[model samples]
Target chain A: MQASMSCRPKWGICKMNQDLIQYLLRLGDSALIQGQRLCEWCGRAPALEEELALMNVGLDLVGQARNWLEYAAELANDGRDADHLAFRRDERAYRNLLLVEQPNGDFAVTVLKQFFYDAWHLAVLEGLTHSSDSRLQGIAAKAVKEVTYHLRRSSEWVERLGDGTEESHQRMLAAIPQLWRFTVELSDSDAVEQRLHAAGLIGDPQQIAAAWQQQVERTFDSATLPLPAPACHFYLSGRQGLHSEHLGLLLAEMQFLPRAYPDATW
Target chain B: MQPGDLIASDLGARAAAPGDLDQAWQVLGRVMDPEVPVVSVVELGIVRALAWDAGHLHVVVTPTYSGCPATEVIEADIRQALEDAGFRAPQLERQLHPAWTTDWITSTGRERLLAYGIAPPLGSANKRSLLGDNGSVNCPQCGSAHTELLSQFGSTACKALYRCCDCREPFDYFKCI
Candidate 1:
């Protein structure tokens, strides 16, 4: 897989190590997309407290995204900064998970989506803390603390919404299938991950998958929601630049100012 | 010397210093946190270390939170303070390893935070607390241990909104992270 042409520098050339760039994009784009999704709740969350919480979490994720993207930009060394990578890239160039790009349905759906992502995120960060790459280890070490809070908050919400009222529980139950199919991608590792794992730059896929499953099961037990069968077949794979229709729309809104003005700055 | 100055001096001795590094520490000790203006960045423990390399002062900093809006301001403020103190174009390095924790906030910083009406983080940033076992936060206003968390987040990423059961006053608790 070659580097996305759009990600190439304006001199019509790319001098990046393809595998490293791809790996960094996977880390950064996931955080960026997920952060943007959370920020969409700014003025619309159920209560003031929830609003603040959502935005705070969003801020953390975006900050982490900047860190990862900054490193990616450095590695690319292709005349693009983190902002350029974030705003200028086309939808097909993004490497975020399909789950994060999904719409924030109702509050229940949003919470469940966050819970699922947080579980996987914590597992990945915990693993990355032990990475052979010191830079990744440092980023992961810092992020693990923040994601721990995120997971705790989301998992508690899962229990609350799942066991709270007939309406809330039913809503949580309904949200399951709308989001569960995406879980397949959480544990699915392709060659990029396999190569990184072999080099000890990343965690073992089997261990990460096991940790993610254990976390989901523990939270599901507490939430009193029965676990559904894992989705076996899903052609969706965001890492390969295959995204749903939702991502293009999201990029249209998120990239509007930067794309329009080109030279805008605060 | 003030208690804050004492703590800063103690930390200053940790590094085998030239006169410049010690002076830099003194200068940073007066550079207050932008968000929590009552405490200096040194008191907050974000100024991780200071050194001189190739005729340039090198200061290492860590953000209190990953998404802290105040990080850039704090970095700029540190540079400005160093420059104002006669160091030419001091370099700032952001270190992410051994991630910043509330446990790093100094005792004097905690006292200043209480005096400023925000409760300092209770206990340590331990594994149990990270698992959501939040300890009791005492009211900074009335010195009562009876306080309830109004929200997990507050006006800033580093704080949680809390209301004192005794005085019925709402205050910010610096979250343990």
Candidate 2:
């Protein structure tokens, strides 16, 4: 990481290439974490259609994560596959944004969190399509299409929940502030992100932030829900592997069978 | 479960190979989709590639839908089929880029799908407009273009619930992405 510290002015290609694994992890971790959270609702969603939809969204994220982590493993050249990258890591080693790993509280909370994440996901993925790295470009080109549908579904739910009923409105409003702070860390670029930007491996997070804000505001207006106050000290950035207590519990469950069974394939 | 082979140490090394890809493809052709038993994975176009690496057979597979539950089952079936056909350990690589769109569904695959009572996806994946969910869909049961989507989601992740006007029967519409 010391080599990575010397990044800002002009990043060393070798060092930036090394940081590429971490960059991929940051992206992959978010998807993997969200997928794990959503997969928990496989049989528990309120309705059958909703259940399949939730599981599908989770699957899409996991699929994206598998692509990213597989690429990351290739970049690291360490021979580990995506599954190892996903289930083998400890909780503290994960680099997902704080937003995704937040527990799926109520149905409203889950939908709102997804909407928030998808909003940022779209902004970032669209910019990523033009990455100088052909691998990133290809993945982004494929992923942007998937996330577009994801955002549409989540945004529709936000609108219905926010405008539908007294209970649904309150639940949606309550979940907004609960998860809003996590969105701040999404656009806040860290050192690794800066290096990837310098290398043209990824897009500028600032532009993504601007797009995310515009889209979120438009969505909130239609949802009839007031956006929460901006930036309190609750900045929970999971980028550097720091995460909430909830992550550990989630990991314990997901990694259990994998860790126990090791190389066992289905 | 034997954890030693699955451990991460030599995990990156290519699996042992026989390079028997022709036999592997033949085996794969017989591995049907778990949900739709009539159609094989190859027909579904999910098995993207078969190659030899590190003396082990490597396969590239892309599921029809990202959230399709049968992804795991299909992979297992492919592995088991190849292994049963006397190949050594086969490696499966999942690629999401150039994501699997309905366009990848082969013409033969489309026929198999239609015969299976699920309407096939109508449009190409490239022209994906967000809200255009209501395109004219032919009912597989009646071959009627007059079909109404009852729900955007079906019993499984990759389908939509629809009812046909001509046949007055509820069926699954393999949605165009």
Candidate 3:
């Protein structure tokens, strides 16, 4: 099948290489959206240490986004660089998972969101460590160390919340049900996955799902929160350009300067 | 030789030779933090070593804090600046040892930050001496040592947000670690 029109070559633009850019954006946007959500807790966290740790995780994710977006721009063969790709894209152009765009409800919800995503992120990064794409592999290798710490920190919080005060325990337990629906989407399969998997740029989502389930199950068990049933068909269109209403608002705030003043520099 | 002439003659070879230190320091001052983009990494104390090795310039930098987001971009900007100035591919060596401390932020950087409207970090000695073991950071703007830490985490992980009683300006304090 021919590449989509959005992926096609345009006047004054280099040869279209949308698949690679889209794939790279998928990674960058995931980190970007999740990092924004994490940043919301900057001034408000359960405790001082926890606050720093969460902020560190957010920084790591945004750092990862910068690296991946830079590579995406390079692959696009367009003159656009990391800043342009990150700040110039329309809402419909982003391919981040819907779960990342979900607002941070509370401390417990925030930890749950992080725990859910970190578990999947580490698994995917581990797989991508040996990708055929050199740039992707290098970024994943550098990010794996950071994400490992993220997983450890979030997992500790999960257990602490699960075993903490009665109020904390109940709040954390309630967070699980609302957050579980998002996990199904993380390992959801799609045509893009098929192409990338064939190209050896990604691993099988089914395998990733199986591994992620085992990992999260053990962490939840330690957290004392029972695993909730997965949604059969969670928000599935995010990777294909469809997203929740919150995503556009996020892009607007994130891309405001670039949109307002084109080619503006620091 | 007289005492002064003997001292000068002996010091001529021993004096630290002025190399690209001045130029590198100036260029680094222009290289801002990749994420924040307001503060210079040199002022942030992330630049460890700047030397002229053979014909190429070598710069060694460590992260401001462990896994700080600006390290990668800082390295990139360093390379870009040197190349733009007609230097060869600059050698950027990563050194994790002697981890960066907010205490190392040059006085110039602190002044620049204040002039830019963002409060500078309290000197490490002042904070360590004042807070005892609790590690309280005083506000830079109002000289109000009585400040409460809003979050151990600031807008970014490398900083902590504190509010002052005198001015009530919420500012990001560069964490000592």
Candidate 4:
């Protein structure tokens, strides 16, 4: 919901307690899955500095995931802690965007994926900073710094790959169509978003979508990449626990230990 | 006063009276990391030195990473802890170099980290970075030399994902500086 200048502590508490676990999960899973994708480049980056830089971005996303997941756990209020929410979720239960879970095909593809997500995420985070809910506002304030850097890093790579050699340009161009179909879901306002918006836990999806489109167009212009034609929405329905095929394998790898040794603590 | 004499006086004064440093260490150790309540500031290796000089407590803190968000919260916690310990307000300064290293982690701290479900740093002997060409990192839990790095970054910037072959657990090892 859009933040108003009027201060009502009662509303803040009530609004903060809104059940937006699905919405928060969307944020958390996007970062968590994308962090996994970025980690694929750990020791294999084309350049050493670039390796550190890429890992840096990956770390930021993982940290962001932890923050959002913790909040999501609170929002769920079913005694699920952040660890439980993150590690115990089934493949179908993950609420990440389709683009984030896509395999990191190549450096160009990874950059394109990041550019798209960062543009949307940064705008969303910026909007959240004014939330009537203090916790979300606090989290957003901290995340904005990290997301800003992430945007800068991805933007630079987009430019380099788009304007570099012919091969790189072609690769960058190809990566766009591969990921562009998934962008539509980012703007799709559904029940969870509606609840969050009414409670002032989040901004209107339309506003975020408009800002995202402008930023995306500007970045594409700079990168010399063209926007893909509009297509049917590629929805994964991660909020309702429906997901693509990739999440199962990811969960298998991530949740193996905890599931195998149930209730085991260090 | 000669520079060396000033340094010696400072060192002599330090040796004669432990000052607020020992007290500060004890008090600050009680300050938990805001995000990870299980970890203390000392365990995080953020509080590098606690000195009592000019009738005030000086705490030199090195951030976990260049842009770690917890620094401000940690600093506030440190000040509050010291104030609670009877110093009106402590003087805090941040030091960035010889940057804080996971190598500085105490043995007890390492054990705590493992118990907390995050892997401890590989010993200095086993630690290497991409900045260098040595690919040796050990699993802190099992002492298995057969560990592979899963990710250069982990849940946080200060960590790396590592999988131990012997124990077969993927963990976030606090990365070496």
The prediction achieving the highest DockQ against the true structure is 1
Best by TM-score: 1
lDDT of 2 by residue, A59-173 (tens): 8788889878988888666667888888999988899988898999999999998998999898888889989988898788777877887887899889999999999999998
lDDT ranking, high to low: 1, 2, 4, 3
lDDT of 3 by residue, B14-115 (tens): 222337578768877888987657778787778888888755677898765434655677788887765555445567887644434557888887777666
Model 1 per-residue lDDT at B30: 97
* Superior candidate under lDDT, 2 versus 3: 2
Clashes of 3: 0
Task: Quote the positional error of residue A67 for candidate 4 in Å.
Answer: 1.6
Q: lDDT per residue, candidate 4, A1-266, as tens digits?
A: 32222325567554545446667888888888888878889899887656876777877777778778887777656677888987898887788887788778888998889988898898898888878777677667656656765776688789989989999999998898777777876666687687788877788888998888888888788888887655465545655666778778877887899989988987
- Candidate 3 is graded, for docking, as incorrect
* Cα-based TM-score, every candidate: 0.91, 0.81, 0.64, 0.61
Question: In candidate 2 chain B, what residue range of length 10 has the lowest lDDT sum?
Answer: B1-10
lDDT of 4 by residue, B1-177 (tens): 323334334443332233556766887888987766777989777888877776566788876654466777899888767665655446788654444556677787777777776766554622133232345666666767798866555666666677898899887766555
Clashing pairs in 2: A79-B12, A263-B6, B16-B55, B16-B56, B17-B55, B17-B56
What DockQ would you assign to candidate 4? 0.06
Question: What's model 4's lDDT at A155?
Answer: 82
Task: Give RMSD to native, each candidate.
Answer: 6.4, 6.1, 11.3, 14.2
Give a tens-digit lDDT track for model 2, residues B34-142. 9888878888889999888865678999866654667888888887776666556668898766667777778888888888888887877654544545468888887
Looking at candidate 2, what is the lDDT of residue A16? 72
- Model 1 per-residue lDDT tens digits across residues B28-129: 999999889999999999999988876567899999887889999999999777765666667789998878999999999999999999999878897678
